[model samples]
Target: MQIYEGKTAFRGIAEGKIKVYRKDQQQIKREHAENTQEELLRFERAKGEALRQLTGLYEKALKEVGEANAAIFEVHQMMLEDPDYVESITNMIRTQKVNAAYAVASTGDNFSQMFSMMEDDYMRERAADIRDISERLVGILAGRTGSQMELTEPVILVADDLAPSETVQLDKDKVLAFVTVHGSSNSHTAILARTMNIPALFRVNIPLDDTVDGKEGIVDGYHGRIYLEPEPRVREELEARQAEERRKQELLWQLKGKENVTLDGRRIEIYANIGSFGDVAAVLQNDAGGIGLFRSEFLYLESEDYPSEEEQFQVYKKVAESMAGRKVIIRTLDIGADKQVGYFQMEPEENPALGYRAIRICLDRPEIFKTQLRAIYRASAYGTVSIMYPMIISVEEVDRIAEIVGEVQEELKQQQIPFGDVEQGIMIETPAAALISDLLAKKVDFFSIGTNDLVQYTLASDRQNPKLEQICDPHHPAILRLIRLIADNAHREGIWVGICGELGADLTLTETFLNMGIDELSVSPGLVLSVRKKVRETKLGEKYN
Candidate 1:
């Protein structure tokens, strides 16, 4: 028996036979081509075929997973068709006078190395994507069919690492769990596993050999361990854990569509915080009241260049129409800080978390801000769409945001573009905003306290730093006091205040939020019903009443 420990991507328990996934490493051999032109033609043909394969994969992933996961293939397709990639491969073929396969391999190696050496973690991960696409093209040129796994029964899949394309192509039913030797919790594979609700353990030192294949294995996602040929006692415990998880899921399902009201009859809105339109399905499945925080930064982050107003409009419109009149509070571009965009040309910051980001970036780059504002305004015509600005510290910032929104509305009116009256709000994240809540509350329709930043800034501790976690308490007296102040001030001004941060989902604080008269709590979709259940069980205006 062998035991391995790793990090959990999702919490679950499963026992199955091990299925070692060996990626097809297509060998590129040097071959002398009589004509360079012929080699270029072959490269073009292979590129076209690779694109067709990617498109097929995209459609399959779209059907199986959601659009967000399927977008991986679309990115792969873009990489294959990128002018820089094409020029590099062609240049090598023309300059070296070698076959298409060798040229592709050489160019891919150089590009992948360049990406691997980058300081940014995001750029470093792109190395894997480059290799995946390059191998696909090389396989096509070599007349080698791509590898496919045909599993006879359910198994725990073991791999060194899984590319996004390979991960999406997996049969969800056949793959009971995932154990990988090489992968980050933030990787695409991890994201897919979470989306599929599968047990996954990454960075485990699991041997990928024929001797280990088909071995009975138990994956404890909660503990991030893989047990090979576990004893009866261990197996029984795992079975019980699995049963408990199943029961909890069933209970959450029953809570769906139930009113989020306290025992004392105080109603609180339980909405979902979504990164993109693709998350709408999960929101509906979980029966959220509405989308409270539609993170608009994803639109900017996912794009190769500045997203045009029309491009942004199409996505915002789709999300609004799909919500079908459910209130959607779309937060304006909150880029920088932790989330950075490549094309934005932002300078290196000594302190990015406190530097020019969110509202600061939007205010400075009004063109980009207005483009998104225009899209939001246009989408409002389809359904309920309200805009929220993040990282506001002063009333002047809110006034500036209002001014830009007004300008967008006027431009739409002049263009004869159909748009609905949209509500404007701001995120009270900084201590300054909380201290001046009364003055700021009158400037916006509502206030959504981003407690993630609020706690970090209030306590003078970096929330991302694990060592400082003890100090970064969301339930701290100061944090709770600030939330109460914001709620009180917003209520006095006839506006509602919500929490759209991680703190809102903390079950322990749900009753406290209710007692403090918080109007809404926006959390991840999976937590909506659970939080709703908490709301129903709590007595209003009580501490353990």
Candidate 2:
């Protein structure tokens, strides 16, 4: 038997014949359809065809995977007809004068890539589904049908990787398990395996070749290992370990309603970050203490034009009410950098991350800033609401924000509009912001460290550039020291501090953050429980003091 280590996406065991997954030619050529009207009509036909196909798949899935899983196809159908998604594809075709296939492909890539990088596991899973539907539409337009796996018997599925679109096309009953060379725990294929109660692994370093296809394979998800043609003795040992892992999984349910307190009696709030009203359900499902980073940029990113104050207010209010008295800190526009909206008409910059963005844009255009502030203030009456400004480095920016906020409140008062108290805070995401955090902390009610950008700026490495992934180290003592600096400054001013970046979800650093006097840690919704578990396990007594 040949053993290979992998990351566990789901915990289970399956021993069966191996089936390798291969897919269709997915290269989409960029071409102009020349006529926008003609291309749009073509896209409509393809979308219609996609909807029909999903309906057929839905019925099939119902028989094979039950209603809960079948609902994915139904949701795919709705997504195919979703106005926003359709508009995105149509707008690209019209503006760029692109072919229907190219439009669908480009728009899908943009949307899917955005969701894939999100911190939330559910949101990440959604990335694959978006790609799946997008590719289906592209395939129809391109007149291409990819490789289809037709299994007559149950097998342990092996692949270099399986796309989200590919998994739904499989016969679930014929798939005993999934083992991929690449994918995350939240990838669509992994989700499918998880739902089916089968073993699944991702990022296995082993080579995937035809030599192993059709051979007996063993997937031991508990210990993150897969065996090709395993010996009988190995199978027997794994079965015993598998049963123990299943028992431990049952204990996972007990984590709910448990306090996020350290072994030494120190407590910290665990919050979830979200982008839209639709994400509130996941936030609550994960049992986050509150919504720490409600990215307000989606209000801009998803809109054709700047969202109206009432439009922004309605969204914020709905989320606030949904939280039902839990803390809701809405971050102001964090556009530019990696997130760009076409309507902004921003002049291209060599380095947008360090250029006119976030607070800079807001300060330059107070009218836009005031509108958002007014909406946030108006929403404050619905629940416990707080407003946070992003990309602030100077005391002057905070002063300007205060001035604008005052103007907004005054306008509301003149109109006799009722709004509740809203706490003000700023993001400490730059070296300059970190250096002067003590001064900045006194001006805001709280401080949220945006470690993703902070690490990039500190290390002079672009966080978005994959080439710098190895070079940009978030664990450098420099980053830890910075967090401690920001946390200390916030505490010195008697204001709470929290991390609302990628590092907040890093379980290894939970104890370090707690010791730094971080009052809260905001992470992706699906990771809330894991971080909470870590927090409860940390023991810091005199060291914290």
Best by TM-score: 1
Q: Which runs in model 2 stand beyond 4 Å of their true positions? A: 2-19, 25-138, 141-226, 231-249, 464-467
Q: Which parts of model 1 have CA positions greater than 4 angstroms off?
A: 30-36, 81-88, 94-99, 300-311, 336-357, 413-418, 430-438, 452-494, 540-545
Candidate 2 structure quality by residue, lDDT tens digits, 1-545? 89989889887788889887666668888886768999999999998888888888767655654443455676677668777889999999998898889889988999899988975445566777788899789888888654367788999888877765467677777787888887776454675566566678988876666878878888988789889888989988887776776675566557889999988798899999887776687788878999999999877865657899999999999999999999999999988865666678899777777898998999998889888989999999999999899998899989988988988889999999999999998999999999999999889899999999999999998765545778899998888998998898888899999999989999887887888889999997867888888888899844332
- Per-residue lDDT tens digits for candidate 1, residues 1-545, read 77999989888898989999997777678877789999999999999999998889888877766666666787788789878989999998888889999989988899899988965555567888998899888889878775466677899999998888788777778999999998777677788888888889998988889867889999999899999999999999999989998998899899977899888888899999987777999899999999999988877766778989899899999999999999999999898876777689899887788998999999998998999998889999999999899999998888888888889888989999998878888899999999999999888899999999999899998775545768888879999998888898999999999999999999988888888889999999988999999999987754322
Each candidate's lDDT (Cα)? 0.87, 0.83
Most accurate candidate by lDDT = 1
Would you give me the overall lDDT of model 1? 0.87
Once model 2 is optimally superposed onto the true structure by TM-score, how far is the C-alpha of residue 347 displaced, in angstroms?
3.1
* Model 1 residue 429 CA deviation in Å: 3.5
RMSD to the true structure for each prediction, in A, is 3.5, 7.3
